[model samples]
Target: MTILKAMVLYKQEPIENNPLIYSDIDKPEPGHGEVLLRIRCCGVCRTDLHIAEGDLRPIKLPIIPGHQVVATVEEVGEGVQEVRKGDRVGVPWLYWSCGRCKYCRRGLENLCDNALFTGYSVDGGYAEYMVAKADFVHPIPGFFDDRHAAPLLCGGAIGYRALRLTGLLERGEGSLGLFGFGSSAHMIIQVAINKGLDVYVFTRGEQRQEHALQLGAKWAGKPTDESPIKLDAAIVFAPAGWVFIEALKKLDKGGRVVLAGIYMSPVEKLEYSLLWLEREVKSVANVTREDVREFLKEAAQAGVRTEITIYDLKDANKALQDLKHGKLKGSAVLKII
Candidate 1:
């Protein structure tokens, strides 16, 4: 058996407390319909911090915790025909879903109850070697490098899904509000602007607000600040429920807001005014394979740029700590073998 280094979470605790253990473990082999990969990079998402901090409880213990994966295939198991050896691929949040469910039948596999999630339910890419379902693995576009493409596997794809769910493409001319200027919002803003929509960003902290402005946001302000112009749509990437109400206040009539996080702070109260006038509210649980393919193509073609903070794979704990404390400016990524 090959020994590989991985950051395994044996318990859920605060990120600063060092919940993940970096140790040498037996490298996993590709099972039937699976592909073994030599991980190049893994993007550290807020969701990873959530798993570490107990915001999202782990379904299993001693699990590797990284979902935004970019790697090159080293081996393929039986029935794996989608990708061959030496192929560069990405493993996203949607690990694998049962194809028999109604949600899967409706092309909404993200909602499948039997869905297996990477890093949460199964071992993920915090390790140098990872095994992913061949069917679920997506081919990385040639333009995007391993480190740069890592965030797109989760933040970029899911954020693009949220933007699509908000129906921003439905209206050609209108303002779009982005609540929170984190990894996802930063990428989505460029796509929205490229699509000809005026992007307004609502976020706290001058650094993030300035980053938003640098990304071509027409306006950037705190969540409490009122928008000068009503927005046709909004996407709440922040985990604060109050951001939902705040986005609604800025949306025009018949507008929509999509909450993109798996967890969020409670909504204290819902005023009638914020939800009336055919305005809508929705949540994005996860990303579909279609979303991954579409976003990668579009992102590659549009030349989307991201601010990246790189860390060695051994420093996974530091990356998670930085994410938990809001120290990261753009996206945090682990550079592995």
Candidate 2:
């Protein structure tokens, strides 16, 4: 039996409680239609923090807690041919879904009731080895190295999908507001700038505001401050629902606000006047495979670059702390291999 090092979350508790502990465990093997991967890197996401801090309920206990996996396909299981040995690949949050479900049949697998999520429902990639459904693992483009591509699997991909829901795909260009200049917002601002959209960023941290300006944002300021111009669309990536309310007040008539988190704190009261004049609000759900592919393609073509702070796999808890306190700039990624 092969032994591997992994950071296992034994309980759903606060990060201060040290929920995740590093341990030596049996290496996993690929099952039928699955493939084994030697993990090189995994991006730390807010969702991981949510689970670790008990904001999101855990579906499985004693599970590894990471999903933005950048790895090498080390082995293939029975009937798996999508990837060959030594191929570089990525594993994202969407683990598996029953194709027979009506949501799946309608190409809305993200909303399927039978969907299983990596790091939440099953074991994930905060380890030396990981097993992934062959079809769910994506082929990483050669342009990005392990650290950069790791985040695109989740943060970047979700930001891409969420941005699409804001009507940018149909309208082409507009004034955009990104509330919370965190990991997802960093990638989104770059893509929006690449598309020639005027982007205004709102973050309470002066450092994040400056970082957004360096990324070519038309303007950057605190959420309490106002945009010089009304936005055609807004996307809220923060866990606080108050960002939605604040962003709602900045939209142009007929503008839209897309809330992009899997979980959020309760929103304060929404005034009818803020949503008058045909404005709309919608929340983004889990991403479809199509969204991932499309995002990867467009991101590559646009030469999108991700700013990240690297941490060793052993320091995942510390990394989570930095994210919670906004100590780390850009995105956080764990270098395991």
Candidate 3:
């Protein structure tokens, strides 16, 4: 058996004391319709932080934690055509879905009941080698480097899905509001600006607001204050429910609000008038394969930029800690040999 070095999370705890242990494990093999990838870079997302801190339970112990992966194909199994040896590919959070399910038949694979996640359900890209289903991997654009493409796998793709859910793609001119200025929201602002929409950003901290303006947001302010102009549509990326209420109040009539984050604090009771004014509130769930393909095509053309801080694979725990405490400005990435 061939051995490979990998960072394994054995128990849920704070990442400070190195909750993730480095060890030598047997390298995985490519089964039928699978490919073994040599991981280059993997983006550290907020969901990884949640898994490290034990907030999102359900993952089996002694697992590798990483999802947004960019890698090169090292080997391929039988019946693999989408990728071959030396091909650069991207592995996203959604790993596999049962094809015969009702949701999968309708092209809504993200909603498939038998879905498996990359890092959560199986060993993922935190190691030098990992195996993924060939059909699910996406081809990285030629213009992007490994580090640049890693963030796009999750943040850029999911942000694009949230933006599309808002109905802002068809509207040529309107005020678009982003309720947070993190990795995902930053990408969304760029896509919105590229489409000729005026972008407004609401986030805490003066530094975040300034960063938002630097990224082409026409106006940047705290959620406590009112916007200069009412927004035609808004996407809330903050994990605070109060921010959701604030965004609804800033929307124009018939405006839609897309809740992009997976977890949020409990919302306090609010008056029904907030939703009574034809203001729609919709949640963005897991993304479909179509969402991934469309976003990659647009990202290749729109030239979306990612602000990232790179760390060694051994320091994944540190990266998660910094992300949990909001120490980094943009996205964090872990580089594997």
RMSD to the true structure for each prediction, in A, is 1.6, 1.8, 1.4
Per-residue lDDT tens digits for candidate 1, residues 1-337, read 8788999999888888888999899989999999999999999988898888887867878889999999999999999887999999999999999988999999999999899999999999999999999999998889888888899889999999998897767675678899988888888888888888899999999988998898899999999898989988899988898888888888899998889888789999999988889988899989899999889888887788877999998899999888877788679999996
Against the hidden true structure, what lDDT does model 3 obtain?
A: 0.87
Pairs of colliding residues, candidate 2: none
Report, for every candidate in turn, its global Cα lDDT versus the true structure.
0.89, 0.88, 0.87
Every model's TM-score: 0.95, 0.93, 0.96
Best by TM-score: 3
In terms of lDDT, the poorest run of 10 residues in model 3 is 52-61
Write the candidate numbers in order of decreasing TM-score.
Answer: 3, 1, 2
**Clashing residue pairs in candidate 3 (N, C-alpha, C atoms within 3 angstroms):** none
Q: What digit string (tens of lDDT, one per residue) describes model 3 on residues 191-241? A: 788888899999998988998998899989999888999989999999899
Candidate 1: where is the Cα deviation over 4 Å?
170-172
Q: Which stretches of candidate 2 lie over 4 Å from their true place?
A: none
In what order do the candidates fall by lDDT, top score first? 1, 2, 3
Instruction: Name the TM-score of candidate 3.
Output: 0.96
